[model samples]
Target: MKQNYIYIILFISFIFVTLYIYSSEIKEPLEDYDETKNPKLVFNGHWSGLFCNINRLVNFLVLYPNTREIDFNVLASKTHHKPFIGENIEIFSKLFQKYKEDIPIDTTYNYDGLDFTKFDLTHRKAYEYYNENRYKLEPYNKAFNKYLHLLPHLQERLDKMVNEMRSDCQQVIGVFVRSNALADEQPTGIMPTREEYLEAISKLDTFSKKTKYFLRIDNEEDYEFYKSKLSPIYETNIKRAKSNKGDAPHASGEYLSLEDLENTYLEIALLSHCDILVHCVSNMASAALYMNMNLVSICVSKPAAQ
Candidate 1:
């Protein structure tokens, strides 16, 4: 067993060496697509979940277009789990390290006046248009996905979750359901009913020809609720990450260690790998798109006051 582990380590090391050599020797340049010609995008703003922050980063980059390097160290994660800043920096740094060779990523963090959040846009309509449906536009989605990729660590974690589902032939479908508690916080401002989500899932299953489902629920009640509802038809499951059950764990006053936070992201990483995803239009929902996964986003808002 120890010898096997050693061999695995050596194989991984060899693969990295081969990749670095391959990247270095490639002198052929695509002048049109060269980022060195473009101005760099310095990222620093609302660091939410994996999806939210990533979506914003992708949106901003797409809107701007010309960029040589992306500065992300200052863009801290705004997780409910952590109280102060710098908690999730390690994970972000890891992501930067894993993708730096491809995108020339800069891992230095800074919060001076240079923060992207401080930079306000005068044209709201133009900004919103490019940011919302930005990826679908020319050269945005294709370019972003090319540079952004999850590290092998996250990929291995996602693979473990998929294997745990133990589906023999059932196709995996991901369902992203937000809770009533987060209704006001959601971009859409309205929580889809259990029935509405079920309908969406049924349609997704039919559309994708999938038999298994992984319902990624934020609240505990919803987890049990969907498990019961989905079990009757498709092979359904949820990520059993710590604090994944019941109410708002972040607001629970518990200090979410770096490890716990990584577990939380592991769930998102797993969801990103699903065969098909039915999601609400939010940052968490948008994060999956960078992985080149299929997405169906549902957005419904509460009626405005008269």
Candidate 2:
């Protein structure tokens, strides 16, 4: 019996040693976004913030082939599936949790279509080509929008919540006002103002006694400011995102934890259901545009004034 036990222990040790050797042999070439050269074309970027980063991902994927890995470590803090603002971490898996195909790519092979392995973010010439010439959506890429879909569990929860919010049966409109924590962050020479919002609201001929609105603004004060200014006949719903110091609204505060990120996305998803979108130049609005391409945008700012 003693001899048999010794032999079994030796066999297990051999197996583990072999596995470790194989793992170490595997090369993670472009581990971070800055390196940029990968055997497979890695779609990655810095964390400009949630919706903005997602827009970059979606827009790039829309024009590219489907068989690439989302290099989640770009601005991510850790390689694991958590939201680390100081670092990107692998939040992609957590954010788009339900996607099951063409993801978690193998290191063995590349996509069958156009090979952009040599290209990186510093080169954006391809975007100019596709944007001007062949901007039309191909059937295969139409599902690219699904890339950012919420996990099944969150979807079910939000669906019920959104349904209840809209149960009053009204003409619902979503308004996204873009602002951030720093006063200097507002776009120079073209910041959106109360006057612009009022002018946009006045043109919403669809507003009636039954009309309801969802204001997905940057700050709680802005939320109430817009809410009070809009016609009294309409109702307003605002998602109270957890305060991040002054980075309220849809921003990740000092830290980007999983819960804060999830709520920000939830606000975007729920806003997609609105009958119309009155917005500033916001990536959150771009997210709603993902769901309804034809939705009318009431641009709160007038370029003529600028």
Candidate 3:
């Protein structure tokens, strides 16, 4: 029995040694890829926020291909599935308490509100307090970092669009018009009248006798309304983007639904294509400044209501 026990002990020690050697041989140091080394393409919309959660996820899968270390949870809160500045976080806090997970970090950014003394300051302060208390949304930082990694690529996308527009028009003047007409909602600020739009174009035409303008808006209704108002002013030189519907509206009152694809991406692309951007108090106009660095930015102030 003693001899048998000794032999068994020796066999176990040999097995351990063999397993350690095999493990050492199989292990390799992980390599980190610098995402910023290449250009990036940002895909987002108004509801998507600065870091488009879904679009970025897709981009990661397509761009990284083999990267497995990229963990989305490490960056964003589980509540991010339905993100709102202050409202959703409250719901998340309640859920977190029930689950007893590690406390989340606060990640509140800046905001500009129309009212401060009233309910506005209360809302802003709540967000600030939340930022002070919660786990910071680390994903935004990662997303922004990845965005910087592909800045050159995004710049290239911008450059390509610029070159194409320049070739199409003798001179390209980007026209950004307000788009609050959703469900008959009025846009804030002093919107340019038809005459004003024509006057602006007339002034631009002086730069090039055959100057053409690129107009971007949310809905086809606004596009047609503006086009009809401007055609007599710019004549046949006027080129509005063809409606994806493959048919034109019969009159000013006609409405057309926009493509269901992300509105934020369309807004960003439209703003990027502009040489000069005109915007109102709409959220897209508010956030446009952050996304498009090269455009000449202009904000039309909202008119006071009676």
Candidate 4:
């Protein structure tokens, strides 16, 4: 009888242990939990540009579906220099609607070093991952559209800017020319040159008087060059880093005014509204594509060796 009791106890203990392990496996592990029952993610910019940071945010949302809120204060405080002054969270709120609740500027939490291998979709490996997953990108795109809504005020501003550009124009050809300091920052031949851009634009039916160009060039010289070549060009009058001595202006370890930041946002926002985009591989271009994947684009690559 005692032997029978011991066997029964052992069987119950095994059952309990199995149940505990299964429940733990099913539950999403989080470092810290809030009252909302979801983990708050802290976005670390790593001194990246605005659109790159935005892309990282979207990628995080897609990969970690359980994240309901994100704090950017940590990024603001930790960077070598404040990229943009003023309320960071408020600026983000003006651009994107609240995903679930108001994204508080919680400084209590820090970036938990989450693996963001999937953040950079521009990488070659990401394309392979997409193909291996049966080429189904609907989920990722859906997450992007769901979380990336421009507030009505910003939307109104964007619409006004685009409408003015579209006025007296039948079509807008968006061009993103990555030049100036980027050539020094990136590996050789990674960034397309002025000749390459012009060659690609030459293939387009841009001779029409009704087609206007919206140039998103980084430097004044290239901007002027493209404007001269591609007549009737429109662009945001934002600050440009004409030097090749260091990083781009926004990421040059200098503090930028809130207005500068807003202009940068508007520039990318405007690029998405274009009927056709002609450009290279860049985060700004990538963000624009994410905004409007259906946009007809002509992506230029470096010339192959002879």
Which tens-of-lDDT digit does each residue in 1-306 have in candidate 4? 999999999999999999877554323233223445455666555445566567666666665565666665324421533367643433454356665555553423334223343344543222222212313444556667776677677778888998988888888899887754444322234667678788877877766647989998777777777888887878678888674333567666656776776688889889978888877666666667667655565766443344
TM-score of 3: 0.38
Question: Which scores higher on lDDT, 2 or 3?
Answer: 2
Q: Which stretches of candidate 1 lie over 4 Å from their true place?
A: 1-41, 47-50, 64-66, 74-91, 98-140, 163-166, 185-188, 204-210, 232-247, 296-306
TM-score of each: 0.62, 0.62, 0.38, 0.70
Candidate 4's C-alpha runs over 4 A off are 1-44, 65-74, 77-82, 86-94, 101-114, 122-140, 183-189, 207-209, 243-247, 251-253, 303-306
Winning model by lDDT: 4
Candidate 4 — which pairs collide? none
Would you list the C-alpha lDDT of every candidate in the order shown? 0.51, 0.53, 0.36, 0.63
lDDT by residue (tens digit), candidate 3, 1-306 = 999999999999999999876554323111223443322222222122322333333323333333323222312122322332223222212111111113332321111111011221121121221111212223323433333322344445445655666664554455555432321212332344445555655554335444556666544656777666543221222223344232322112232222212232344554545555544333343223333444544433323354
Which whole-number lDDT from 0 to 100 does residue 32 have in model 2?
24
User: Candidate 1: worst 10 consecutive residues by lDDT?
Assistant: 120-129
Task: Give the clash total for candidate 4.
Answer: 0
13 Cα displacement, candidate 2 (Å): 52
List the candidate numbers ranked by TM-score, top first.
Answer: 4, 2, 1, 3
The Cα RMSD of model 2 versus the native structure comes to 12.9
Clashing pairs in 1: 47-78, 73-109, 74-109, 220-246
> Cα deviation in Å at residue 132, candidate 2?
16
Query: Given candidate 1, what's the lDDT at residue 28?
Result: 18
lDDT of 2 by residue, 73-99 (tens): 334543322245446455555667534
Best-fitting candidate, measured by TM-score? 4
Query: For candidate 1, lDDT tens digit of each residue in 1-306?
Result: 999999999999999999876544332112123444444454554544444555555655554455555666433433533332344453454454333334444332222222333222111222222223534433435656755655677667667776875355356667777656555543345666777777766655454453667777776666777788765223333333333333565554544555555666666667766666666544555555454424433333223343
